[model samples]
Every structure is written in structure tokens, then in C-alpha cells.
Target: MLNRLYFIFLLVPFLFLSCYDSNGDTEKSATLPIYQDTPYLQDYSVKYYFNSSVSPKKVFEDRNGVVQVLGKNGLYRTSAGQFLVDGTLIADNTYRPLKDKSLNGISLFQDQFVYVDDKAVLSNAWAGNLFLPHDLENANLLEPGSNFDFLISDGKELQFLSKDKAPWKGTVEDGNIIQIRYGHEANVFWILGKNSVSTFDASNNQIKTIKINNEATSFDVVGAKLYIGTQNGYFTVDSELNGKPSDLINKLPVPSITWIESIDEEIWFGSDEGAYRMDIDGDFNYYYGKRWLPGNKVVHISSGHEGRVHILTDNGLAQIHFDPMTLADKAAFYEKQVRDRHIRLGFNASLVDLKNGDVNSGRLDDSDNDGLWTSMYLASQVYRYKVTGNEEALKNCYESMEAMERLFTINDVPGFPSRSFERSGYIESLHDSDRWQHTDDPEWDWKSTTSSDEAIGHIFVYSVMAELLENDLRERAITLIDTLMGHIVKNDYYLVDFDGKPTTWGKWNPEYVNARPIMVGDRKINSSNIIAMLQTAYHFTQKEVYKEKAFDLMNNHGYFENLMRPMSEIGKAPEDADDWSKMLSEGWNHSDDEMYFLGYWGLYRYALNDTLKTKFKESIIDHWESERPEKDGAWNLLTAVCETQNFDLDEAAWYLREHPMDMRSWDVKNSHRKDLTFIEPNFRDQTTEEVLPPDERQVQRHNANMFRLDRTGGDGSEEYSAGDIWLLPYWLGRYLGVISEPRLNKE
Candidate 1:
């Protein structure tokens, strides 16, 4: 009875197995792998350095010599070789020769020197302790005294640094001393702190105080006008110090003001983070961290001779020489530095095989390697750099692209007849008869179904290569495109698995039953890849097919819907389309929802569709008129959208003016566990485990935000991406024609 039961169980499985064709024969076979004969890798190197502890904090030059504040150490003289400590000269080779006491502040008047210590003890002398004066009222000083300057210590009860000494010497006032600054001329000065301003006339022996509620941080005198930098904001008072000062101007936001000085005619202010210069007309320019200063936390700023500005910071001293000829030259220099530091990597082009018959299941470059796709993206950036008149960048891009091209097969096939290229070092099969089946879990499975997207990347790359190369290579590109089209048409616009079955495209939840022609055989039609191909094809052939494809994809599919979803879902119009059901249902699972399909949104408005041009006008007004309550995700999204769409310049300008992406806590990091719940191990090497640190994850999000700020289109936003050759042309073509007010808010 047991043997009979076991036989029945085996017979039942055999009966089910015989239900389908036992031969496992299909109409089509898997395509043969097209291996590129010569595959090459590009070699490039970059070097970077960070400042040392002994780096100078502030640098200033006088007719007598160059002076620098050595942070905790006292002021050092650069004119003579040896270090001057007190009155004596130290050894020539001594790197740090000053005393260990914190020298918070320093100022030079002719040959005399005045400085405040960590204890807020104001001291002055002609030659280091000789003829020292210290009779002034010694009170407890504040902790952050680094930004303080020595106005005056009269060797008596009250010091007259900002206000006139004659009248205040005898009078008693209860107002708090928040900040002080000496006027351009003698005996005329201004003093301000919490909610009041005190002015005194020394020769006339007259004193006047104006009560104000705003918190004043620092003040500076430019001609007769008194510019006050306060915690609330910046305001300018008219020349007359007496009576209620009229013609007050307030426009600029108040960053933590540390010190203010006049450099030539420019009003330069030292802040807690960095330094900024404002024109007489109140246009402000900022230089921070690696830009003009050595460190972000600027302690003090002072003017030296001959167009040079000296800056003192918590870290070290820095000197910036400005030429009035081109005001933005300094910013341009730093931009170049940042661009040189980062390099991208990705593949540009691929070949499809169709001889063995299974079109959708055909191999990319006859294999599943991904390096080719990776190199192309990196090369794309390089290509942009080259075209944008960055000679060095162009060279790097060209070399990288050339190296990528060498890693392919240079032979003719049935579907792709011209020379075909595959990703470097990827092998298709080990067994002859079972080429699709792996005998040994092949090294870098280039023939895997996961490589289908990479194949599309190759097609896009060829479009770029077509423009870059000349003569025969260019002709080969056309053939490559034709072959790719044939393969796609035969495969029914879908990638195939190694078992000759159609594979699903996209990750997680994917849309699109049939892969759109615009996106080739990719799972879903995405704005990024579509725009890339459209731009490349348009630039290369100036073909109507490419333009039509871009237009059709833009309108038919929900590209616009996806792009405008964030701003619209917040209840801002016709553009919104009320499409939140899908998003809302997904909820936290949609962590990547806000990841920004920047390529799509940026390119759609950049493409500038005439059909929806009128709709854009209404959308712009609606977006501006609507109130934005939140300061986080929605505001950031709208800001980016407005910037890219060039919709409401006034609104975008208002946000930028009101909430400049604060760089104060720029280096701070937040946790990602609140968003992404999972951390996967690194796959390339099984030995190493990869976990996203809270800071690193936060930085990635912040970087995306910064990229928005830097790349967003509009005169008010930073023009960092304006010079980006690859992306800028598309931006200019779309928005430049739509003339609008450059300034956000009308004064």
C-alpha cells in the first residue's frame, strides 16, 4: 500500500508535467552575442587638499607692512622675516610664535595697535605693551568677541568709539550697547544696539539717541549715510544724525553680521559664516568658505591699501584682491574650481543582436555589461564642458568618450551591420549549445535581462557619438540606429530574458504595457531619457522625426502631469489635474516621488510647447497668487518648478530674496531612516557591508536642493547652470523668448 501511494504521487506529477509541451520548443531563438574586438578603459586622476591648522585667519596690507591675525595667537607682522612677539623678534623658522591667549580682535591706527582679548580687555600700545593704556571701565565681555573692533578706550569711565566723547562723558543713559561704528569724518559717530541709536557731536558737546525696536548687529559709515546691519534685517539712515532720521531704506536680509568695513566705495560686511559686499545702490554679492575666505565663520573685515580686502575668521586669515572692472570675476573663478573637482561616469551607446531570432530577448553589445552605459553619462557631462568653452573640461570629456568607444566590437551583423560595441570585459556565454545559459555564473553578467536599460543608454550615446565623430564613423552611427530600430521592431519593443522570454522593465511599480517608441524598449517612458534622446537626435540630424517624437511623448503621455503634480497637488489649478489618488495611496512607499524628475520638468518647459503656451500664462498667475503655507517640501518644489518653468519671476524672486537657501548650517546632516526604511549591502563585493549614514543621506537630499538652486532658470536664481553647454541650450531656447520682469518684487 505504501509503494502504491508513492507511485501514484510520482505519476500525478508526471501527468501535470506532460500537460505542456515537453519539447520546450518555441518559434524564435536567442540572438547571438556581438562582442566588440577592442575594449578600453580611460585613465584620469584628480588631486585635492584641505587647509592646515596654522592657516592664516585674516590678511591685511598697510604701507608699513602686511598684517595677519593668527586666531588664538596675537597679530603677526609679515613684512619682516622673524616673528614679532611682544617687542622682541622670535626665531625665523617658528611657525606659531605668538602667546597662547586668544586675540579676539585687532585694529591698526597709523603705527599704534589696539586689540581685545578673550576676556574683553581692551588694550592699546605703540610697540607691544610699551605705552599701554588700560584705565577704561573694564566690564565682562561677551564670548564671541572675535567680531569686535576697538572703537576707543579714553582711559576713563566711558569710551567714545562710535559716539562723540564730549557729550557722553558726563551723561548717563540706560540703553544697551549693541554695536558701534565710527563715522568717515572725525567727531561724528553712530552707536546702536537693541532698540536705539545714539549720535553725539564732540565739538558741539551735543548728544541725541533715537529709540528703535529692531536688533542691530553692526554698523558702518559710507559717506553721510549710516548703514546699520541688524539681526532683523539691514537698514540705511540718512546723513543727519540729529532729529528723527528720514529716508530709511531696508531691503537686504540680515545675516549674522560680525564686522562691517568700507573697501573703496563697496560696503563689505563680515558675518558669522562668511563675507559679503554691497554696492552703494544696495546690490549684495557674497563670498564664503572656499570662495573668497579661507573659512565660513568670518570674525572681522578691514580694508588695506590698493584694492585689497583683509578678512579674519575662526579658522585663518584670507586676502582677496578685487578689480572694479568685472565685479563677478571672483564668483566665476570659484565656479571653475568646483566644476574641475567632480567628474561623471556612464555609457553612451550599444548594439542590439537579432540573428538568432528572439528580438526582445536579444543581447546588448551581445552581453549584459553595464559599464558602457555608465561611461556614456559621465562622458555626456564632459562633452558639455568641452562645448562650453572650458578647454580643459573638453579635453577630459573627449578622452573619456574616445576611451568608451574603444570597448566595442567593430564588425557587421544581420540587424546591426556596422561596427557594434559592448560594455568592456563582459562575456555572454561559456557553453556553445547553451549560450544563453551560464555554466559558471559568469563574471559581470552582461547578457542578463537587467541590462536592457543599459542597451537604451547605448542608443542614446550613439546619437551623441554621431555628432562627435566624423566621416565613416558618423555613417556607421546611422547604420547602428537603423539596426537598433529593426531589432526593437522585431522584438515588439520589449527586452527579453536569457530564457528567450520578454522581461518586465522598470523597478517596483511600473507603467506602460508596451514600451513606447520614444523610449525605445524601456519599461516606461521617462522624461529624462526621452529628452536626452530627443535633444541628441535633434542636434545631430535636425530631423523632424526626432522633434515629432519629443512633441508626441510630451503631450500624449502624462509627462506634464508628472512634472506639475507636486505643485498642483498642493491645491495651486488646471495644471494640477487633481491626480493625488495614486500618490496618496502609495504614501510613505513613495520615498522617491520627490526625487524630482528634473530631466522631465526641466526639459518640458525647456522644450517650450506652443500648444500649452497659453496655459502656462494662467498657470503662472495661479501659482503666484496662491499662498504657500509650508516652508519645507512644497515650497522647495514650487521654487524649483517656478525656476525651471520661468513661470512667475516675481514669486520665485520673492522666495529667493526672502529665503535664500541658508548656508549657515550647510555642513549639517539629517537622518535618512525617517524616509528610507531599508539599507542594502554592497553587491560588487560580498565582503563589504554598505549602510547609509544619517549625514551622508541627508547630504544627498541637500545636494539635490542645492542643485535646484544652482540650476533653476531665471535671472533672480543663481546662473550656475547657464554655462552648462549640455543643459543650457535647451533652457535658453525655451524661456529666453518669454520676456518677464527680472526682479521678483516691485519696490
Candidate 2:
């Protein structure tokens, strides 16, 4: 049964393909878009290192841009000192010669290194900790500005040390002492207490003190503002320290920040929660877990020569860098990723299946609708092979074709394709209503009661293979189409089964279609589908009966009028045509849009006559015009199959490239976002004021509403595969010459 079915499937395309003239008016000429090169967004390259022998304290760059890491045992330098690449590491500290055995802190001063142990020890070329300050206890080196100074404090007094100068002492008058702020060449010095900040000038004159409720731990001067990290969180105030401070801890991932490094408007914070980077816009991206960094407990963060940000954690050190790529580059990389990572195996064919992005492999018999999705992926490879001549693409296309064709012969009906087939005894019915039947071969079982969705998919893939396939494959595709169309016609345009009755949704006869009111989307879609099917059959077989039946439906049964009607008149059915059809169509059906467009390949491409072709183009344009606001990559790119001003080439590429790399189906909540623009609710709740980025929106099939912010799978949790969804539009765009291969970008 499978062998005969596969043979007819493989031979269907050769019989009728290339029937339309390449140079004829059927293929119209329009100015296609020219897309610019876009760089691919690269994934975060994170590498971890942990050695119990050494506890890293700080990772920073010296004045010369060379990366230096200071650990508990000693200090070390990287081989690529100028830029911290992923694996840039040198030997452990080989020279640990210091006057004092303990080295707690460090600062660079004009070709000299200052170390803080019991006192300040300055080390230079050919020397190690040669200069030590006397009477300095708990001393610390500070890199506030151009000058490398040392600061030491007791409970009553604070002293500052500069290059080749004695210590300058200052006294503070305030509530019980907390910490002192003395950095960033300013005229005023500040003393932080529990209740207020005490300010003193260069001559020890007390300035007006600012009162605060929270206790501060550290402070830094960034631009014209002063950021104070307190027990509650970080707060920002004017540089003068007398103005009100605004709390910014809510933006950070943590509650309390121990240290902060503010540079180039990018602030890095070491907080109780983790390591975080708060950008100029106040948005936060973090690195904490061992999956991202060496340790989750962040102690310090500092930036160096390159874009690398050095991190100091409780256990070890880590460095990270970012390099941006254009959108075009990302599209290619993602396309390849989908092919390599998501395709289902064991069939010896590249069939993309929904995955959880883990070790779980979704079997072919896992779902009844796998054939539909697999066909979409197969069609994409057909196009990819035609465009790039990739042999792997062609081989995958052939293998998937074999799998799709078996759906026909595996069933008892002449041309009815089952939703899915599995080896008997290995499968159980998912529900009571499931239509599983044992095949003639006792070893196999197949799903019955297939609907129009699977039928449209079969026709669509077979049609595409005819145009794109060559050699024996072309012939097989044509023969398969003839068989399926023949069966539909022979059974009175209904998918009859073992029970000898039409399946619930496989009806297209005048009796079933006309029974529905003119207002029903089913009426219009059925009219549209049958006409396209008849036209395809007539074109492939050169049969007069098929054309006559098409004309009878069009002229006598109002199928032509049903299809030619404007899409705007969809929801406004006349009062007289009020019934089940009208009730079912009170709201517009978006799935019909999918049905119309999928059938459109046959309707417009293999249209039997020029008159029908003109109406087909007009209908497609009207539908696209209404849907343009969605900014959907799938619909927009699919419409590009017809080259016109309506096609958005740039936006299409942007949508794909900007799609998030995280493909998991995590529950996303966008209702709390303060940045959304809202519009009044429309049909199916699709009328959102603003469209969220692709990643932030609900995970959905191409047929689902793109603007919806809250969406879960039918079963509440299913991270669907990106295989078919991405491949369809990508390969379609390539076939239409809308997007070209991107240039390889280098960092």
C-alpha cells in the first residue's frame, strides 16, 4: 500500500508542471525590492573557570589597557592584555614579591602600582612594593579620576593622600558615622551618617548637610549626579549632595548594592541579588548563575580597555563582551540553526517537529497534524534547493515527499489522506472521538476524519514540488496530484472514508456549501477552495469535464460571485441570510485567511483563465491591505509571492532578525509593561494598541493573532518548534528573491 502510494505521489508533478508559460502574461513583471546587508545577532559566548587554589578578588585593566586579575593568592595578567577575548588567560602570578604578605586592594599610578596591605605600598618597573606609607592602617587605594590617591579613616578623622604629598586630615560632625565620600576632584567633601550627609569644603568649613532616611554603604560621582548605594537600594541626587535623591534600586535586580562602577553612562552594580548592568535608559540585564558566570555572588564589577566587563565574584573571575551584528546576518544564522537543531530525526528526512529545546524528541506519530507541519518544512527545502542548489535540501525534500504520500494508500478510501499513521499496537486513541483504524497491513494504523487543513497542505506541497523538483521527483509529484484530485472529483467533491460518508469538514459540494448562508466564511472559503481545486485538476489533466464542472459552479452556483466579493463585506452579511452560517460568522475568521492564502498558490499561479487570475489578484490585494497593520513576517512575506508596493521587504527582514533567540515557551506576561500603547479590543481580541516584540508576545502558530500579549498553548504548556514557522517565509522570500544570503560579518 505504501509503495504504490509513494509512486503516484512522486510522479504527479511531472505530468502537469511547467504548463504555464514563463514568458507569458501569467508571470507579470514588477519592480522587486533590493534589501541591504544586515548583520546577524550573535549568541552570548560564556565560558566559566573555577579553581579552589585561587580565589579571584578583582578583574580590571591597568592604565595601559592590559587586563590584570587579582586573586587571593597573587596577581596574573592575560596574554591578550589589550582585549579580553573568551579564552584569554596567562600563567598564574609568578612574581609575588611584596613588603607586606597581605595584598587586599590595588590602584595604578603613572607606570607604578600601589598596593594596600597594612599601609600603601607602591611598586614600579624592576621593583616590587618598594614604597610603604607609615602610620597607615586599613589603607585603600582609590581610582576616582586621573590621580591615584589613597584614603584611610578612623572613627573620628578622614585623611586623603595624593602623589608625593603628606596626608590631609578632615573632621566630620554628624549622626553616628556610617561611611565617607572623598573622590572625583570636587570642592566639597561629604560625610555619610545614618540620618544626614555632612558636607565640608577644602578649608574644613561645614556646608549645608542633606537629610536622608536610609543608611548609605557606598557613593560614586557620575557626570553631574551623585549615586549613593544605601541599605535600602541605590539613590541618585545632584552632585552637590544637598538635593533630594531618587531611589533606583527598583530598576536593579537586587535590593542592596555593595559596589558600583559607572562609566560611559553604563552602570555596573554588585548587589545582594547578582551582577547587573543598568544601561543609560535604566533597563537592566544581568549575569549571576553558574550557567552565565563563575559564581552567583558578585562582589565587584569594572570595565576595561575593550567592551569586556570584568566581574569579581566570591569564588572566581569572569569577563564578558558584546559585539552587535546586522539583522540580515542573523536571519541566515537562524535559518541554518532551525535546520540543524530542530529537524526531527529517524525518518532519515529533515522534518521539523515542535521541541522543548531539550533532549525530548517529538515523534512523527506524536500528533495527528504532524504531516501538515512537515509538509510546510518540505516545501521550504524545495525552494531552498532551487535557490541555493544545496544537495541536502533536495534530499530532504525527497524524503519528506515519501512520508507525505503514504497518508493516501495507508487509508481505505481511494484518495483520502489520514491525519497521521503509526505502527499498530504502539498507538492508543487520544480521545473517544479519535478516528484511528487499523490499516490493511496489520502492522500499521492510520488516523481518519481528516479535514480541509490537511488537504490544503497536501495540495500546496505537491504543487510546489512540481514547480521546484526535477528528474523522477517531478513526475511523482504530478502523478500524486492527479490521484488526489481524481479522488475528490470521483467522490462528488467530498472526502469519503471507510464508512462511505464525507468527513465532517471535507465537504465542498453545492449541497453542503449552499446550505450555509452567503454571510458565512465557510461559504466563501468553500467556494474559493473548490474553484481552485477544479482549476488545478483541469490544468494538470487537460480534462474538459473538470473545466465544465468549474464553470457550472461559477455560473450556476454563484461560486464566482462568492469569491469575487470584497473582504470588507465579510462581517456585514445581509439580514435575509441569517442562520447557522450567519451566527458562525458574526466575527471574522482569521483561519480563513490562511485557507485563502494557501489555496492562493493554486488559484493565482495555476489559474485556468485570465479573468479568474485578475479577480484572484484583486482578492489577495484587498485582504493584504486590511492585514498590513499586523506587521506579521509570515503574512507579509507570503504576500511578497505577488510582487507589488504592498510588500514590506525591510520590515520583513527586521521581524525575522529581531525575533528572540530564546525559543522556549515560557509563560510571558506583558500586561504589566508600562510602555505599551493600547487600542480598543477588536474581534478575537486581536486589536491591541501596540504590538509587542515577537519574543514578548504569546507563542503562537502563524495562524494565531500576532498582537496578542497573553497566549498559552492548547494544553496550557507546549513550547512549539520554530521549524515550520521560520522555514516557510524564509524559503518563500528566497524563492521570490526578496532576501539574499547575507555577507559573513567579522568582529
Candidate 3:
């Protein structure tokens, strides 16, 4: 009988999973392997800066795959560590140094250097060969020929030199030449002018010129195809010199192309705004501003060492390195980042006021949402502990857990958690100093006016710990949950401060919650959060009062109807409503999205009954469907808890993979991108038809609008910690068994 009873208990979980699958049409499972790395190239940047007065004109890779930049003054070479080195001349047989002065042009033929001076095209290939000596006048550009030896241009005319054949000369038929490039596959020399393109067949010395719709700016040749760049956009020309209409290929983020090149079989466009690479899918990987480049004005581009892209701008040179990385590898990187500079007195902190994205030049500082942010980090550590069983993750949870405990004990209020606490005597430095209060301990001060956000965050992490932790940690988590909820229930659903008054945004009483129209997001969010809090409080403490209070609010106050309302019906308040309600409903509050998703953990996992659990799943799925367009990894991963078959697992991985490695809040601008489609302004603040990739926009947390395009006047002063923004969803996905373990050794 005992064995039969144990067998029956073992079948319960399988029965639950099977029954859960019946509710959805598709199976809710991960498509990727359970223990393999999804391989992709993770890009990071290395920058080389010269003196401020230097004007960089062109860039190319040397025979050894090192980068070399040519400027107005002379050529500069990149050292072993991407540092600037003075250019040196190659010596001849007599050990006489070749002159490096007035070197106007540079190129490569068969991996050997071929440079041009004022009088000749020179090379060190065969004991210093100087072809076309004194024949070329004022040569400024040089390119290797396909059928001949080399093609040299002087901004006005072109000269082709060969070792065994007579030199061929040509001039643009329609306009003065700007650039001349040799199409190796077609054995043709393509010429770009101010307003037209001309092709030269060196075999027959034939020239064909065609006028373009826009003023031509730059051009590149890849085999039989010639890409022509103009002032507004670009078009393609075939080997037969057939030009496509400009409008057919004009769609680009930045159309003012200044330089174009084919590097590693991929088309890279350099513009006045920034540089971008077109992938095989025709989508763009934009590299803009200080995050990826030293300057916006790109002058030239080349393929660098080990598949890196070297871009020379007006200010300096940037080499973007693409390294092979998996999602697990990225997580470890973020973990080190948080531990190195983002931890302050056991709380997750932001490094603000850095000079030029330097990690050492900044100081960790507190935020208004201290508890909320720390809770997210602590929850990440909790999930990390559960997934990998790493002792370090548990230690992280313990340390941040101590910080959360102190938030309650730092102040005189019994259960009120302070917004943040800092070393005393810095009151003047804190934002809104009026909210700061001194503790009895002279060494510390605590922030007041704590709101519902802190309350929900505290309960969310506490419940997670109470469910997943062991021994003393579990008991402490349950106790804290009861203490916080006890205070709220005693104060009539309000977070009362030391001044004996309810804090603004801390009210969840029926009078406060039910006053707003149902369309208001606050009404829905507040109702959803408080119910989840009470349910969590009851589940851990086994308190009858917590259970009774939750049912009372849900049954008597109609919170179920409010939270279960479809997202489509949510909009601006009725015209006749109160000013506060109208103000609250003016837009969709993204902060509310964070709070609601956080609250969903308890709302669904700790539901009072299976019937309520099913309804909670439906409500969660409804909200997740509305958030589908943003492709938010955290929201999608959180929605997976509802047992839905499709939660955009692929998009979640994309978000994780595409998130920028640099967490600094660099000034990024995407409004000038021609590829984005603008939309009519709405309450949700979605500016485009589709959201840009995470690396293309400004670095922001989950609460900010994903569609926000530009951050002007920024100086890269602040660097956000990835603990709350990135690690939370990543470790959560790991804990949920959707993301795989690291195939590469974690070491």
C-alpha cells in the first residue's frame, strides 16, 4: 500500500503536464537542444585615436592583417594592441629607407604593397619596382587591375600600367572623376563621378557613361555588380553597365553614403551619420555613435585582422571585433560586469557620471527604485542558484537579501521598506532630499515616500525565495513576506510612513483603486499587484487573515474583472472622468508592465485554487499577446510560466543575443534611419511599425519605451548595471528549462 501511494504521487506531475498541454493547440517546449550552445558572433569594439589635428582619409589592412590609416600628414600603423604607431618606410637592398612623405595613395596586389607618390606608382614586391615613373601626374588614388598591372587615378584622369604591356589612359566622358575602382570579376574599371558612372573595358579600351538620378558620391565593385552611391541613396549597376532606378534600392537607415566597400563578401556602407553592414537577410547591423565608433563621419572602410571591420572616421579609427559567443558565455560576462563595479553596499547600483565610458572614472549611486532594482537582481541570483546549483549564486542571493532586510530595519516603521539607504551626510547630493530621513544610527539615512512598486518587488523576491530556498533562508523569506503584508493589511491597504500618512502611489484601498475608470492602467495594475501580494503572503505564512483579505478584495471589490479586461479595451479615460483618472490614462504606463509581470509569478503560481489558476493563466496570456510586438525577452520568458505553447522563444533568444555588450548609456540616434516606418502617435508611445534591435537604440531598462529612437546631448556619463535588465530574464529562462546549459565550459 505504501509503494502504491508513492507511485500515485509520482504520477501527479505527469498528469498535470499532460492536462496542461490539452489547453493549448501547440506543444510548449524549447526548440533548441537542452545542452548545446547556439553559436553566433558577438561583436565588441576596439578604437584607435590619433592627435586631434590629424585628418584620417583612408584605411586598409597590411600584408600581416594589421590596420593602417592614411591621413593628410602621413600614414599611421596600428600596433599589436590597436595603439597608434608612426608609419615606417620599407628598406631596399642597400638598407636605404624609402621616403614616406607625401604618400597620397595605397593599395595591395597579390598581398604585396603598391603605393603612389607625386610622380610614380611604387611597390616593394620585386626588389623595389617603380612602374609608370614620371608618367602619372599628381596621382591621388591607386587600385589593382584585373587584366593589367595597376590602375592609377589623379581625380581628373585614369592611367593603367603593366609590366609587359603598354600603359592605357582614359578620362571620364560625362564628368570629372571622383573615384576609380577595378572590377576584378568583370575585368572592367568602374569610374564614379559627381553625377554619373563610367565603365572602362581595358581589353578593348571601351568606355560607357550613364547619368544617375542623384549626384553620385561613392562606388564599389563586387565581381559583375557595381554599387553606386549618391547623395540621397544608392543603386546597382551590372557588368553590362545597366543601371537600376534609384528608388528601387534606396531603402536604408542612413542614405547619405560617403564610402562603400565589399568586405568579407558583405556590403558595408559608410555615411555621414555612422557605419552599417548589410547581412544576408538584407537587414542592417548599425554601428553608430561613441558606442561603436569614435566619430560619425566615416571616410573609409576595410577588412581587418581575423574578420574585424576597420572603419576610419574624421576623428579616429574604430575596429569592430566579432567574437564567437553563446548566450551562456554572455551571461558569465554580465555576471563579472555586475560584480566588478555595480555592487554598492550589497545593493545593485548604477555607475553614473563616467567620463567617456571609463569604468574607473565613475561612482556607484543609489536610485529611486532601490528595492525594486535589487529585488530583480536578487531574483536573478535565486534562479541562478536553482538552475546551476552554484554556491556563488546563493552567496549573491544572501548578500542582497541582507540589503532587503535592512530596508525594513533601517527605519522606525514596522514593515515599511525604505526606497533606499545611503551613508549619512550626503542628503544634499540625493535627488529630492526632502524624502530623505535620518536613522537612529548616525551613520546612515533612509529615503521615504516608498510606493507600491517597492512593496510588490519586495513581495515578489520574498515569495520566490520562500518557494525555492532551503533551511534558514526559506524561513526568513516567509517571515519578511508576512511582516510586509501584515503592515499593509493593518494600515487598510496603505503603506503608511513614519509621519502617519499614506504615501502617494502606495494606496490600494477600495476607495483609491476603484475610483479610476476601468480603462486606466493603474486601476488594472494596482488591483493585480495587491491581489498577488496578498496571495503570496497567504501561501507562505498560512495566515487565514491574508487569505480572507485577498478573497474580500477579489469578490467584493471586483479586482478580477479589472485585471482580466482585454488590453485592446484599455485607452484614454472617458471625457467626463476626474482629472487624476484622465491623467493616469493619458498613456500606457510601461512601469506598470514591469510590475504586472513581476506580480504574475504569485498570481498564477500561488493561486488559491486550480480554477483561479486557469483564469490567471488566461489573463497572463492576454497581456503577453499585447506585448508580442516589442519582442521583450523578459516578458516572453515570464509568459512561459503560464504553459502557453508559443511565447516567442526565438525572439527571446534574439533579444538575449542582440543586446549590446556595452551597458553604458551612449547617445544613440535612430530617428534618421530611412528604413523605419513612422506611425500615428498613440497612448503606448510606439513610434515605429517595428522595434529596432537592442544594439541599435539607447541602452535602457525594461520600464523605458522600446520604440524610443534618439538620445541627443548625451555624453556617455552613466553606465547601467545588467543585473536587473539582462540577468533577470536570462537566469529566469535557465530556471524554467527553456534556455540550455553552457556547452562551453563555464570556466
Predicted model with the maximum lDDT: 3
lDDT of candidate 2 over 174-270, digit per residue (tens): 5354454554467555566556666655444445577776777666667777677865567777877755778555434565777677766888777
Model 2 misplaced stretches (Cα beyond 4 Å): 1-30, 40-341, 344-357, 360-365, 429-433, 514-520, 564-590, 711-719, 744-747
Candidate RMSDs in order: 20.7, 10.1, 8.8
Worst 10 residues of 2 by lDDT: 18-27
Q: Give the TM-score of candidate 2.
A: 0.68
The positional error of residue 532 in candidate 2, measured at the CA in angstroms, is 3.3
CA lDDT scores, all candidates in order: 0.37, 0.61, 0.80
lDDT of 1 by residue, 353-427 (tens): 322111223233332333333333333333333233334434444544453443332221233211123333433
Q: Which stretches of candidate 1 lie over 4 Å from their true place?
A: 1-60, 70-73, 76-105, 110-134, 137-151, 154-180, 184-216, 234-236, 245-257, 262-298, 304-311, 315-398, 406-461, 471-487, 495-747
Residue-level lDDT tens digits of model 3 in 36-96: 4465788866666665467777777766564557666666765323211111221112212
Q: Which candidate, 1 or 2, would have the higher TM-score against the true structure? A: 2
Cand. 2 Cα-lDDT? 0.61
Q: Model 2: C-alpha RMSD to truth? A: 10.1
Model 1 is weakest, by summed lDDT over 10 consecutive residues, at 39-48
